[model samples]
Target: MAYNDNDGDFPGETSTAREELRAEAREVLCRLVGREDADFHPGQFEAIEALVADRRRALVVQRTGWGKSAVYFVASLLLRARGAGPTLIVSPLLALMRDQVSAAARAGVRAEAINSANATEWDQIRERLAADTVDVLLVSPERLNNPQFRDVQLPDLIRRTGMLVVDEAHCISDWGHDFRPDYRRIRDLIAQLPGAGDRRVPVLATTATANERVVQDVAEQLGVAGADGSGEVFVLRGPLARSSLRLGVLRMPSPASRLAWLLTHLGSLPGSGIVYALTVSAAEDTARALRDAGHEVVSYTGRTDPEQRAELEQALKDNRVKALVATSALGMGFDKPDLGFVVHLGAPSSPVAYYQQVGRAGRATDHADVLLLPGTEDREIWRYFATTSMPDEHRARAVLGELEAAGKPLSVPALETRVDLKRTPLELLLKVLAVDGAVERTQGGWQRTAQPWTYDGERYGRVAQARLAEEKLMLDYENTSGCRMEFLSHVLDDPEAAPCGRCDNCAGPWFPTGIDETAKGSASKALGRVGVPIEPRRSWPSGMDRLGVPLKGRIPEESQVAEGRAVARLTDLGWGGRLRTLFTITEGGVQDAPVEQDLLQGAVQVLASWEWAERPIAVVSVPSRSRPQLVGSFAEGIARIGRLPYLGSLELVDGGPRGESGGNSAFRLASVWRMFSVPEELASQLASARESGQHGPVLLIDDRTDSRWTLTEAGRVLRGAGASGVLPFVLALNG
Candidate 1:
């Protein structure tokens, strides 16, 4: 393989040049897969041509198994041979980056990655980059703006970079189903690259799932013009419908039915594959239910530790387990050619998202089963996620005002004291704001930038509306009168969408709709199982002094509450839906009602099963502004049933805690600081219990636990008043 410098410093233009490039790519492809017959798929060669020869921005929209990775590896090697710098790839997830790096190595491409999982290797990677020994450099989107990388390493990489590849490029569009704020930073990085005819750095972005709207948005962000405009960008789109997928929908009446169906029928599917749930609790509970039925299944969600996630992925890939009951986080960049099926316990909010998840199965197999079990509760879950993605105007302004008022960098915790937003949402808003040039993250913390910022209310509103429309489209998909795969492809704007004859509508339901009654009973039992221990707060939140609360450091052991119990987390599969209904806040305030009979029975079951050092000797209630009657009755019922005396409730002074629910620790802690005190009469009664050799933990009851700060603060006050120990009992755990 040789290049002529006199061939005008450009690789391909005439048919002869293209033929030569394709021949070389074929040779590299054979070396990559170790198969002499390996060749490019339909659009792969065109994408390579655009990047290597045309030196233009290109986006590839093809099916999951279209060999998108081969194009990039071949392009990188081809460019490197011609004296171009190493390719910079902005991958989305750490696991995905690892997969890419491994694949590149098989092609004999020297690809190195910098991610959260590898700190020690970074130095070695930097050395390789400095020595010009690395062919490709992979980093997560989050790393694009990291203090060290953005300030130190990125400028030089951008200057000499031969190609920039954005894998999973749909994330760049806010209108897309899975949008990340950090992904928008690529636009800025793209701007810094040289932009001339031949000297411009070529860029390639690829994804399997992006509608026409998303594709246009992503292209605009990448500075790529579509076919309607000047020929600045080249987009190679292929049919997204997978011929091997046999699709169907099983309408389960309830969560129990859904689990029972899975427990009864999972093995009937071809072989090992993925089972997706909408929430972590659902995934865990479903996996447990399946395991209890003698099925080898494991749970994979965002909460699964990164190390464990890798192990689990490998476990599934190796067929060591029957299935991985997972959430949406498991879908992207995972590859297993022989995966047999995909079963969704609940549907995703958009057709695009559903297609991406189902695309995981039947990639290389002759046949793979894809089934959806739709639940009535899915819309509520969709609404919860929808609320988080868009930035709250008030919250954004408050963050900017705090940073501007301070006139310096403040850590997130410091900002939390002054702003009233939860940590996750606050962090997401900061990323969005940072990309918009409102605030900038630095080594010290976040600081206000000189760039003026506008709220862009109309833009966010349009995005929200577009999301709602997508949700409606998803619902329509459930009851579609046409082929399921064709519907999904039409939603994604695939030009060649046609009825997939394998679907239930096309060929009749190939899946069993019957579930075993025994499985249903077992699933109900699993969902109904109660009692999750709430870990006690051992230390106070920092930056509390800013809120005028003089609390810091480890709390005294005597004042710390013992580990508490809740009937279940609010996100639990079985009890969670009911609890959510009971605590549903209306336009005015939370409803004040007594404990429901079934929940009271559940509480009694929790107490009977509790393995306590000493059972609670007495019960005391926390002051509740929104649900006083509910908390009062719950405490009284527990005290009566346990044969323990019911002490008086704690007294709320100074208008009872300030602010509303759902904020960061410092703000939440300070809002409830010094807000409660033990009643004198109750204090005397508790003191009598301790004096009379009844030195057991007294139960402290509350309706719910969000931050657990209320329990900690109340426990401190009760300890001061002479309670020997405090044991917390709550109706629900918020998170």
Candidate 2:
């Protein structure tokens, strides 16, 4: 391999040079896959030519497994041979980066990555970069703005960089299904790169899923104004259809029926693959249900540890497990070419997102199953996620006001006291603000910037409307009489959209709608098996001292509530759906109703199977401002069933703060402390029972537990009144 100094430097008149480059790329691709006849997919060569031979920015929007990675790996090799510097790739997820690093090695490219997981290896990687021994370097979008990297390493890399590749480029657009604020920094990064004279660094952005609007937005960002004031970008988009995927939709009557369907038919599905769930609890519960049915399965979600995720991914790849019940966290950057199925427990809010997830399957196989078991609660889940993604102008302004008033960097916790928002939403708002130039992060924390910030009300409104429109589009996808694959393709602006001839509608239904009765009974039993351990709060929230609560780390064991039990989580797929109806509110206010018989029976079953150290001797209800009848009936029913005395409810002191249902621990603790008190008569009875050793812990009952502060505070009052210990039992746990 040799290079003329002028090779691939000047653009627009290099037909011979371009042909030579493509020939070299073909050889590299062969080496990469260990095949002499390896070739590029349609439009892949054009994308590669734009970056390597033409020296122009390009966007490649193609389906997964379309050899998008091949284009970049081969281009890097060709450019390096031509005396260009290493390729810089801005990748999104750790899994994606790991896969790319290994793939690059096959083509004889030395690829290294700088990410959170490899902190210990960064010094070595930096040394490699400095010695010019690295052919390609992959970094997370967050690293682009990292304090140390931005101040030291980036400028040098920019001057020497050969090509810039933005993997998962859809993240750059606000309209994207998975947008991240850190990705917006790419535009500014491009502006800072040296572009003296007419020559500029070539950039290539790639995504497997992006609609027309997202494509335009990302292209505009990537094609930043060069030194010559040109913002030209070449885009090569192809059909979004996956020939290997056979799509179908099953409208189940309830969550139990869906679980029953999986239990009865999962093993019969072609081969090992993924089961997509909308929520973490759903994934976990589904995995458990499948495992209980004697199937080898695992659960993967955002809550999964990085090391564990790696192991799980490998387990799936090796076919050690039948399937990995997972959330969207397991979607991107995960590659298993022979994967045989992708089953969704609920539809995603957008058609683009659905396509992205389903694309994970049948990448290399001749056929793969794609089934959507749409749930009634899917729309509610979509609304929640949509609202969380959109920034609230009121909350944004409050954050800015607090930072401006401080005139100094403030930590997230310090800012939490002044703002009404919780930590997650607050952090998200700060990130958005930082991208909008309203505030900036520093070593200490975050500080306001000199840049004037105003709410983009109209823009945000448009984005919100767009989200709703996507929801509607997803609904259309579910109910459309037309081709499902074509509907998804049209949504992605694929000009080649047509009947896939492989989907359920095109080929007639290949899946059975009826579930076996035995499997249904087994699923119902697993879901109805109620009792989740409620781990007691071991420590108090910091800053309680400032609020006059006088609490700090490691709460005294005596003051702690004993481990308790809840009938179900509000996010659980089984009891959750029915329990949700119990809390539903009408137009004006809550529906004040007594406990339903079935739910009451479920609660009793939870108590019957509870593995308490000592059985509860008495039942005491916590004062409920809303749903008093429901709570009262639940407590009384428990007492009657156990033949235990009802010690009566805790007294809600007037003038005491009415506790909020949900918020951070600090505020929740302050609001509820001293608000609950044990009456003199019940206190005497409880103290007598403990003194006489006639009973064990008293069961403190509540309708639901969200923050758990109310339970903690009420438990403390009972403990102070000399009850042996306070054991909590609730109908539901709100995550």
Candidate 3:
């Protein structure tokens, strides 16, 4: 709650007018919060006054939990009382929209939202809006681009809208921590909004995390161009410090050690909160491990189903679980007032992102803990996300070319046939292009725009450079000996950045680094447990017939590989660090060293734990040009240990091609089609091995399985040669 503080007053206001406005705001705020004595924070009343009194555009850059939502809800009430139409809030996340709806109702404002998850309620909500019953309407930025919403409904809503609120306004700026292309459309929405005579519609943009640059960007976006082509924006910035949070960083030796520390210490933390992991696999793995350790926890990631995510959110709010092992999915718009702690299994690439996640804790509490368990692989993960999200000129141009050639709107799947990019990267590229005015989304799909589009090379370069700078700042944060809270505030360009006297640096390390040996053993054992099943590819790639490959439809069951085992995922808590190093490319290529004892032991454990119906009669290596030594030695060792014959390596013929790291299944299969061949000697050996024991399966060993094309093709050839079955065994599975 932004308590009514009188020290900061609205400028250019008479004492008499200020008092009257304050009294009115107090009554409304009380109703909104359901507290008779509810008060506004220092600048909250000024923001509300700007919207309700002056009808001006305002940007509120305050700390999280500073009641940014209150300004809008209260202002909407005042505006509605004056015969203004319903308030239209453009929120980013569905979770945030749900919370805003609930919050608005408490204030007695009839609020409703139309989102993907609640299609059944949209008609009812729209009818309510049409009937002048809804006082406030919450929508996602993505909704603004929907064909029906944009073309059919938005114009009428704009003409009648009382106020416009951009929640999490930082998203409108590319410099912000979480940038969404959908947010760029909000600028156009604001520009097209009906003005009140000479004044613009009262607009309020609120965000908890924004540096000076982001603030300026958002302010510029909020301001509409006037007849004279000039506009003014009012900004209210408050201190970014969270006094209740005690921040600290703990550098862990490995992923397992970090989990071990969490297992040993999570119970001792202040209260139920979030444990953030960098990737979905990490979150699910950590959550499973913690649950096995007898902690009540669940994993929340982008992959989680929508209804399940809602349930998980409520579960966490109810404190039914100790914590949610979550990715950034649980972030933004979540309103847990008494969250006790936030622990990061890995450091975010930017301090701004770090602040956003940690801000979730201690929102309404006297004290809360924020800890970052930094990992050595943090930089690698950062680079992966950065590079993948960055715009590629080549890909963007390719998308435009495909759209132009089609001469009509083409759905994403239809365009996939004409473009070389995968669905995810392709969709991202299209979104970037849409924001750049290169393409326009239509009812059918997306069509090329006649508006000239140029790749802003300089802008892209600057974004990339800014990301690297943020990474450097995060490193500085992790290694800083100064006040942790102050360090974060400085990175956010907080004007009042100073020691909070509550952080670990200011009060000395308040967290324990020690882990009990018993907990350590449990975490290690949990992590070391292997056997991620490799479900065989069910169907052949779609375009294989066009590529001169004699394959289509479902793969023949006789030729398909059986469900196999991997020592671990490259993103796993235990063997991930080691497997990553083994597969990592250097200046030349993978180091090409033999498999180490630890990994060998892990593979053996996988083999032992594997529940195979028929024991392997022979072992054959997938000939590796990159990791021949490792693959050969592993296969030979497995054969030696399991007492099976070494049936020799599959031949990698000269004319055949190998798949790259990532692509569509069709493209991947094309690259690896007929890539491996069974030599005559190897074929004879495989037949003999099969004949020796009622045609037992052959263990096909490889360095790693990325696309699984290599394993599939090898299995095809072996089964073609009369082998009963082929079982794939790999050192790691890449996601």
lDDT for position 168 in model 2: 95
Q: Is candidate 1 or candidate 3 better by TM-score?
A: 1
Q: After superposition, how far is residue 560 of candidate 3 from its true place, in Å?
A: 2.6
What C-alpha RMSD separates each model from the true structure?
A: 3.9, 3.7, 2.6
The list of candidate 2 runs beyond 4 A from truth reads 1-14, 196-199, 384-386, 655-660
Relative to the true structure, candidate 2 reaches a TM of 0.95
Record all residue pairs in model 3 with backbone atoms less than 3 Å apart, i.e. clashing.
2-41, 3-40, 4-39, 4-40, 32-107
**Model 2 residue 668 CA deviation in Å:** 1.8
- Alpha-carbon local distance difference test for all models: 0.88, 0.86, 0.85
Model 2 per-residue lDDT tens digits across residues 566-683: 8898778888777777776769788767788898899889888888888888999998888889999999989998899999999997754554566567888888888989999998
Query: Mind sharing the TM-score for model 3?
Result: 0.95
Q: Per-residue lDDT for 56-94 in model 3, tens only? A: 888888899999999999999888988899999999888
Reference-based TM-score of each model: 0.96, 0.95, 0.95
Candidate 2 lDDT: 0.86
* TM-score of candidate 1 against the unseen true structure: 0.96
Error of 3 at 362 (Å): 1.0
TM-score ranking from best to worst? 1, 2, 3
**Stretches of model 1 off by over 4 angstroms after superposition:** 1-14, 224-231, 587-589
Question: Which 10-residue window of candidate 2 scores lowest in summed lDDT?
Answer: 1-10
